[model samples]
Target: MAITPPSNRLWWKEPIHGIELGWIVIAFLWGLFMFFFMIAWHFIGEQNLSTETYKVKPERYQERVEAFAAEFQAQDADGQPLEENGVPVVRPPVGGDAYILARLWEFWPILELKKGESYRIHLSSADWQHGFSLQPTNINISVHPGYEHVVTLTPTGTGDFGIVCNEFCGVGHHTMTGRIRVVE
Candidate 1:
């Protein structure tokens, strides 16, 4: 004789059993609710995470220099031709090291800035090509030799911003990294 479990009893084995059907229905509804809730939350939260567009160009720094020189010359008392060394200084709002130069596999000193202050970064490669990428904000800019690239950043929050090289230079390319500390 074969042994039969209590669950195989007539009452429990019936396909129309109210309790079993109720439980199945309840589980299906709960799963549907959870799936919809997750999708709704994702769509709602992603709206607040938009990013601003930034450009990377070889002529940006040169353009900025020319614009500043023109502006200063216009304001000069004698309207003299703009001298390269006499370009008016536009100090970074956060006031740390404003210019940084580095080689293919190295980074200059890290920068620290305050929230809501404008920072002007003048970057140029000493040797080969390199890329400047600021993470969490996802700003990827390129740096090349013989051309200085200018980037302006205003930290919206207080945290550490990572700088990574996205270019494939020679050996030690994986070790190229830097950081920007944003203080409150």
Candidate 2:
């Protein structure tokens, strides 16, 4: 029997050639493209994260929420108490901060913003974790207790958008549907 040289090496260690080499270069280029694409998408994208964020105590948050409710009790030319399903609707001033409180089976003080105007939305949970999903526009934010999730958005259209809780908080999760109205 003829003795052969030892050739115990991993497949990857073997010299790549022809189509394999082309694939390797293609994969490297694809990775580089994705790296820069994600950076721009996160930083310069419309769905970018808001840089301003802060912690909020639940009690003080509730107090602010109550005050906000009372402040907007008077309605505009459209309607008074601008509400649906008995949830108080808030039509915040143009280019201002809006707050949405998330608790069990409810997003209290439904929001109403103006079209072509920007809004800084402050979201927080009263009890457990919740997901703030704005449908049609497809914006989802995490609502955490004792912490606030802030997002800045401009309403491009005038319509009523739906808010659904995606996080499984308890048995009442299915009932946690809120509404946001955007007016022209």
Candidate 3:
């Protein structure tokens, strides 16, 4: 039913209900509580994203990614280089920097990481913005063009972790998935 104005002119003069007044006070208190809680969590939360970013040209970043991938490229059993969809599969050394480039529909250079070892993963986009979501660990960060983002992470579990794009980029957004293998 549509709301109608009070039929009586004396409606404004009526006393407020006690229950309504109590709810109003409770809501105000709850809002204040939540505001403080968020501030406290920022200081205590362990799942914070890294703020280390650098300005770099897209072409230069791509060149670095290619060189990193080639330096640590894994070989196949038949003596040829291993590649997935034309992108090399690399196994970076422990405590070293690794590079991953996000482009139109894929993330280049599948990474093989050793559990319990730390690695600095450099993430950047070649063309547009992309989302870097690491599964099981639930780490998510934004990948943008012309800026490199560095995240230092240590894998605690050994398994195949997926890197999925949470941002919608284009018609093939659903196909924008990458792989990371963590081994003991």
Q: Report the lDDT of model 1 for residue 31.
A: 100
Candidate 3 positional error at 139, Å: 0.7
In the range 1-184, model 1's lDDT, one tens digit per residue, is: 4486656656555678799789999999999999999889987765332232334443454454445334433223575542323323222345332554446576554555679887767676667789887787867767776666566666889987777889988889998877667888
Task: Order the candidates by lDDT, highest first.
Answer: 3, 2, 1
lDDT of 3 by residue, 123-173 (tens): 999999999998867789889999999999999889899999998999999
2 against 3, candidate with superior TM-score:
3
Q: For candidate 2, lDDT tens digit of each residue in 4-44? A: 64475455677778998899999999999999999889877
Model 2: residue 30 alpha-carbon error in angstroms = 1.0
Residue pair clashes in candidate 3 = none
Q: What is the lDDT of residue 136 in candidate 3?
A: 69
Once model 3 is optimally superposed onto the true structure by TM-score, how far is the C-alpha of residue 62 displaced, in angstroms?
0.8
Candidate with top TM-score is 3
Best by lDDT: 3
TM-score of 2: 0.79
lDDT of 2 at 62: 74
- For all candidates in order, the CA lDDT equals 0.63, 0.84, 0.91
TM-score of each: 0.49, 0.79, 0.91
